[model samples]
Target: NGASRFGRLRQTLAGVSEKMLTQTLRTLERDGLVRRTVYPEVPPHVEYELTALGQTLREPLKALTEWSVVHIEEVITARGEYDDRAERTR
Candidate 1:
């Protein structure tokens, strides 16, 4: 299903705190990148799904993730070199 429940999303995205996840979802919704639906049940149930605009970002985001993974070692090495230089200067 395109839509997903809050709990399901939390389970899928491990290590994210409930509060942070909620806040992130709210931010995305406010940005018009995500649509939120609240069901009128005994206990309210909420679902979130990507808006058309948000869906358009999927490929670019994926590419960025792949690029980060590929260049992670380079980034770490650069950071280490920078830190070493700063330490020598100090």
Candidate 2:
């Protein structure tokens, strides 16, 4: 999205550091899950987009993201319940 800048990606994913983000991008590129494009110029422009193989991940990842958004409250509630039970057992 937005020409595939790192800042935009970091914002979307949240909590990704510069180093870890670079590593993740390289890993995906190596695995043939994503393609990196570079434009040769001063202050070179770059873009990262999913390859066909990577596009295959869209469905599952999208589903997971949607599920988290929908069920985050339930997850937090479960965590609280577990912590309460643990405290009571101590």
Worst 10 residues of 1 by lDDT: 1-10
lDDT of 1 by residue, 1-90 (tens): 399999999999999999999999999999999999999997998889999999999999999999999999999999999999999999
What's the CA error at residue 48 for candidate 1, in Å? 0.3
TM-score per candidate: 0.84, 0.77
Candidate no. 1 TM-score: 0.84
Candidate 2 per-residue lDDT over residues 1-90, each given as its tens digit: 324867778888788788999999999999998888899978887888888889888899999999999999999999999999999999
Task: Provide backbone clash counts, one per model.
Answer: 0, 0
RMSD of each: 1.8, 2.3
Regions more than 4 Å wrong, model 2: 1-3, 85-90
Point to the candidate with the largest lDDT. Answer: 1
What TM-score does model 2 achieve against the real structure? 0.77
